[model samples]
Target: MQRGMYESRAYATLLLKNILEVADPMHIMNLKPLVFTEVSDRISDKATKAALHILVNICPWGRNRHKTVEAGAISVMIELLMDEITHSKIDNVGSNLALLSLNLNAPYKIHSIHME
Candidate 1:
């Protein structure tokens, strides 16, 4: 049987919880590459944004490590966020506010973002 797309918010929550509980730099380093492909497949812009935001927050960043997230995954997520912000209509104030917060608070530095 083919594996289904990740549908469990609970699973995501638990995974985040577990990762935070351990909080190991080496573990984060190991996991980054493994998660890249799966994360890239999540095409929905909102979902992608949410997932990447969570990943960035959970992974520890500093002068030495600079977050455990893989470069490939970060690149893909940045592209998706930029596309969504540029192409989507800001009809809902709440969503716009949330997106704005994410844009401001997200761990990665995004330069020249366009919101549509």
Candidate 2:
């Protein structure tokens, strides 16, 4: 999905979340960039939450976990978490981060979080 397509992006993210829930192969789409972009886009809460849901569904898979870290999901997730912490509005972002941390590249992912 494109950046300008806010409503469409939200719908697409929810759709992907449902699809991922039904199946485990998250690699079905070029999801890395899409999720990273959406998760980092805090302007739209619907899109961000839906993207985080997608991460929650996909991150349990080893390949998708590493793909999330490679896509800079860790840093963006940390930012989202920090935002949540500051606002006292916690949700699944911390869970998503924990899932992403299960990747083989834990050192790199932790370093990225620190860099953020």
Best by the lDDT measure: 2
| C-alpha RMSD for every candidate | 7.5, 6.7
Q: After superposition, how far is residue 112 of candidate 2 from its true place, in Å?
A: 23
Candidate 2 — which pairs collide? none
In angstroms, the error of model 2 at 86 is 1.9
Off by over 4 Å in 2: 24-43, 90-116
Model 2 poorest 10 in a row by lDDT: 107-116
lDDT of 2 by residue, 8-107 (tens): 7667767765776666353533455556555545546665666665664555454656667677766766777778667765564465455555533343
Q: Where does model 1 exceed 4 Å of error?
A: 9-14, 17-22, 43-46, 54-71, 87-116
How high is each candidate's TM-score? Answer: 0.42, 0.62
**lDDT of the candidates, in the order given:** 0.46, 0.56
